[model samples]
Target: GCLPISIIGLLVETTHLSLVTPVGWWLLVYSTVVQFCIAYVSWFAALARLPASVAAIGTMAVPVIGVVASAIALGEPLGAGQIAALVFTLAAVVLATR
Candidate 1:
């Protein structure tokens, strides 16, 4: 999929280029590979032990983790409504798992 888009973009002379140092590009690629490898391993491990229904529901935590991680790491704000929603989601997940 990425190869087709890349080929078309190059053929159309509309390919956008970024200015990153060689080291930076290498680091970016390395980190992407490492992160994906870790994610797949974690996913497979979870599926090995968790029931399908529970694993399906477990995916709901991903957004919650993203919200919290962004607030902490990126200094993003969490409003009252967001906090309430997070609480409700966590409560539902916990209740459903039980």
Candidate 2:
């Protein structure tokens, strides 16, 4: 998903590569290893063990959690439309689980 964008970014910003500090490089490596590799492996392992319906519910909740987390952590707004969507998503998950 990120490959094309990453390639384009690298190509365009090649000249500015020297601006990345050691900390930035370390963070990049850490995030790539932990978030991409470890997280995906753990998620797939969980998926393999979980029932399909349960996994589906968990997958559906990801966006809801992201939105709510962004609101709380990043001070992102949760206006009426977002609130309504959240409500509907939760309602659907509840209905599906039953």
Candidate 2: where is the Cα deviation over 4 Å?
A: 9-15
Estimate the TM-score for candidate 2: 0.77
Kindly state the number of residue pairs that clash in model 1. 0
RMSD of 2: 2.3
Tens digit per residue, CA lDDT, model 1, 1-98: 79999888789885345767789878888888988898889888889998876886758788889999999999999999989999999988888777
Clashing pairs in 2: none
Compose the digit string of candidate 2's lDDT tens values, residues 4-56.
Answer: 99899888774666899999999999998878898688778878999878878
Using Cα atoms with residue i matched to residue i, what is each candidate's TM-score against the true structure?
A: 0.68, 0.77
Off by over 4 Å in 1: 1-18
Q: Residue 64 in model 2: shift from native, Å? A: 0.6
* Local lDDT at 92 for model 1: 83
